[model samples]
Target chain A: ARPRVGYFYSGKKPGQDISETMNNMKVGDFQSIPVVVREDVSVYDAISQMFLDDVGTLFVVDKKSFLTGVLSRKDLLRTSLGNQDLSTIPVHIIMTRMPNVTFCFKNEPLIQAAHRLINQQIDALPVVIEQPEGLKVIGRLTKTNITRAFLSLSESHEL
Target chain B: ARPRVGYFYSGKKPGQDISETMNNMKVGDFQSIPVVVREDVSVYDAISQMFLDDVGTLFVVDKKSFLTGVLSRKDLLRTSLGNQDLSTIPVHIIMTRMPNVTFCFKNEPLIQAAHRLINQQIDALPVVIEQPEGLKVIGRLTKTNITRAFLSLSESHEL
Candidate 1:
């Protein structure tokens, strides 16, 4: 006689479809803190920062702290094989400069970013905020984040 | 009186559960070809092989072709910083030796493998088959593969 009010509470989002749930996943929700280095930093120092921070990619910023390039471990490894003095060579010399850098926006769907990572054959993407001067890297979205999102799918459904 | 069989064919699995679908994804279905190197190969050669193959991780095998260790881009980058002769150092010295390496099996569920990738904080895992002699490296599972699987979920449901 109470209109079956209590029976509807199943502790789950009623009729929540998987596709709808996935589409709601945003890059800002899963992105990690981005690591950035000044373009003038040495390759040796950049490598050191990579190890110290334990990240796979580093965004290169200009004197105004605007994104100018990106650096990956693969880039650093390739340069190491050159037998050049790493300490003397600036990261800008080896970095993948703008106009070639692949990036994403935080408010976008995570799936879109995932496609970019796969198609571009890259490890990470700088999540950027468009600015009057240039792109400002706000976060890092990578395969690791995608993997975590994949795991979360199962985890949420398990409940 | 065919019980409306034709109408029921909506091209979707009947009453399919999200968790059930996820658990059905196997590691073998998403694994990539493993790039391996001999334990005796010089660090320089290993690095070269990694670049040629464009893989982030390399499995190290013994003379018997049994899994012995694993090498990551991080490992090689650290070694490069030593300023030592990379060609003179065998990968065995820098590799993350067996018993310390985290691996997976092809038959394992993708969700389980994804958990390992997140918990271990490793880029990739050597998918292996256990033999009487030792583990045989059969494939490689990485974050890239996991990311692909994530994309597939949204794709399959889009219809």
Candidate 2:
């Protein structure tokens, strides 16, 4: 029997332009939309939000809506156990701050995005849009979402 | 039926120990081993090696094994389209150099690793282990592998 051809490379409408492949993909195509929280928010509130959202990570942003830091579930737990009052303490105090925090643009290819995650040994990344001043927080890319996209793509290829 | 417990809270084993928890976790685990070709290797030879290894990405390293640059299948294809004499062209001419490339350490947390991949917008990451002089490449983490790990963890949680 002949090997099966992947659906991704299969025939498309005659008018479809192949060079525009990336355009068809969206930011949501490979990233998990992380639950974001403001820097001033209490650690207690952030934990609750994470539990409710069923996500392992959260993006910490500033008043200007720019990404400031990231807070992982482990980080929150570690800080909470260290005698810090979750309710009284703001997320900014414990977050992995900027310069230390890494991010990606929303328009980038999924393959490129995945490479960054594995190379950096990071679980979650803030998705931003390039602005004249800098970058604006728009979404998030998580390990969970990347896995989902990979599986979906692989399955499509198998078919 | 009881609600499915998530991986974070699922009690597979007893007695919570932070050190043990960290040790058992495998976020920085690499699925693929990275292979590098020297600057003197012809692009044709590099492409052949990539195919023989069935890898999508290749690192171009120097004699010291220090990562100098990277080459991807897409990059090769584009380069081939412009030059037919790729057999004589060294890979260094078309590779994306070190300063422009992103990478990760073996000790980084999974959340951080995932975040970096998404942020950098790349597909494969070179896993490095710190040595006396500098970092040495140990393994490679790919989107496919991350997806597999995530799905497996999620499935285990569901079970």
Candidate 3:
């Protein structure tokens, strides 16, 4: 069966345009440098990068910092507890590879990005822009960013 | 400032006993083996254990498996990204020590545990039982557990 889409906001009025509502906000406004790790980095090093960056997800990049893949805490955890050595395992081995990643451009609506996060049940999104070579991951949008936006809206609406 | 509590359910009716709504549930019913790590274990090994467990939060246990503290991905990440060696750092050095942890008993109403998680913006709680020696980490309650219950309730309510 096709996975559910926009299931997170099923309570929205049937005629409403979620994308339209989200259009008022722009992805560029919320983007921040993503927690990143190299493809060759050990799973051990990747986990360290996550903790130091205070992020649950890390965007894997190439030597040129091109978007390569994504790895999350669960990925590192799975690779760590096994009988194998964590230092021997590279993060790229477990990352959700590129092209398969759901990403948003700098000007995309924040809500659209959030929808991808919710629908996929993933934590964050890599905000990228097309460069001559490929997609260079510029920043990220996370569920937390959406929540902050929601809170900001609610607070202002109450006023 | 004292952190906010019950803000997650501030919409709750003024006269309502939130616990009353949670009577049908028990922490034991929602508890699972929290991803765990030993206090003395290297931060590197701890990250490995997390991936193996498929859990976001890791309950720290002592030699006797008694609850000592909690380690989150953030904790490990904070310790990892710097020049400090993750392999040499023990988990306890970064764990949120006991008495500072937000937790609940197996018999506490599930709503109460859920409330603590939401109010504090924490990921999981170690379910414990008090013993003469100390608190024995029996199981865990996580946001995913609460989300599961919420989905179940919504489905039933619709029916």
Candidate 4:
């Protein structure tokens, strides 16, 4: 008889029990540095920051550090080429606004995270902690992080 | 003056050219590994193989090594828990069929690859190459690989 995937009865199970499991999981386990910009920043500055940061996506936040929108490389390029004055405009003008942006919780399971990435069709999702009024952006969950976790999990089981 | 988000070239550039620009930019880069299993193997056996190999997903192939379906951990678990007789059943019954699976070409840019992951909501995609008459599965691209690429790209840009 071959070995089976042991039931994770102790720690976490996918679906309905995620919230409880999330509380148990450490935030550092899957955290990734987020690329962020201020709302008042110029589009050129945002683009330059993205290039400097080497990230395809950038999170737009207000002075309070609250997430307001997202500026992707594609979004920047399209907006920049569409306008006549590249240096005079602000990133918030062309950014994809809140409520439209998809995000995930910081303590989410890798499996659930994978599902979010697939279902949303976005490369990266901001990892946030829920507040009474809204969400607080903390880290990021990317397709790469999920893949690495999967690989590591698989390898550990093998060993 | 604030940097502008738009207005780089305030003229009507052809949509095709923008599409080309999007295609040219590399989104993520990483290597993929290929693993195959026969249909006659028990789900238990297959799971063990997956565990031993440190892969979350496995490609179910036929005697000719042609791609058939995919068996992921979640798929296996969902199927097994639903029926107690999974130990006797072959893996092919619950595996996702090839037509339903999304894949990528070797030369396709990372951006396109990332899009596939986002749209498909799958953690891993089998990388294939065009053959004379059909497509051949070469490697797999996963979220982990993409994340690694993103981080490295960021590091390189900083240097």
TM-score of chain B of 3: 0.82
Higher-ranked by TM-score: 2 or 4: 4
lDDT (0-100) at residue B63 of candidate 1? Answer: 95
Off by over 4 Å in 3: A1-22, B1-54, B58-71, B74-95, B102-159
TM per model? 0.91, 0.45, 0.55, 0.46
Which model, 2 or 4, shows the larger lDDT?
Answer: 2
Off by over 4 Å in 4: A1-159, B1-29, B132-134
Model 2, C-alpha of B7: deviation from truth (Å): 18
- Residue B104, model 3: Cα distance from true site in angstroms: 10
**What are the DockQ scores of the candidates, in order?**
0.31, 0.04, 0.09, 0.04
True lDDT of residue A45, candidate 4 = 79
B64-142: candidate 4 lDDT, tens digit per residue = 6777788765565444334245558799888998788787776777656775775666767787766675556788776
Q: Write the per-residue lDDT of candidate 2 for residues B16-127, one digit (tens) a residue.
A: 2222222344656635678878888987788778767866678888888878888875566455444247677899989988778777777776545655676666667788
Per-residue lDDT, model 2, residue B40, is 86
Best-fitting candidate, measured by lDDT? 1
True contacts kept of each: 0.42, 0.06, 0.03, 0.05
Off by over 4 Å in 1: A1-15, B1-15
Candidate 3: TM-score? Answer: 0.55
Each candidate's lDDT (Cα)?
0.90, 0.64, 0.68, 0.62
Cα lDDT tens digits, model 1, A48-156, are 9999999999999999989999999999999999888899999999999998999999999999999999999999999999999899999999899999999988888
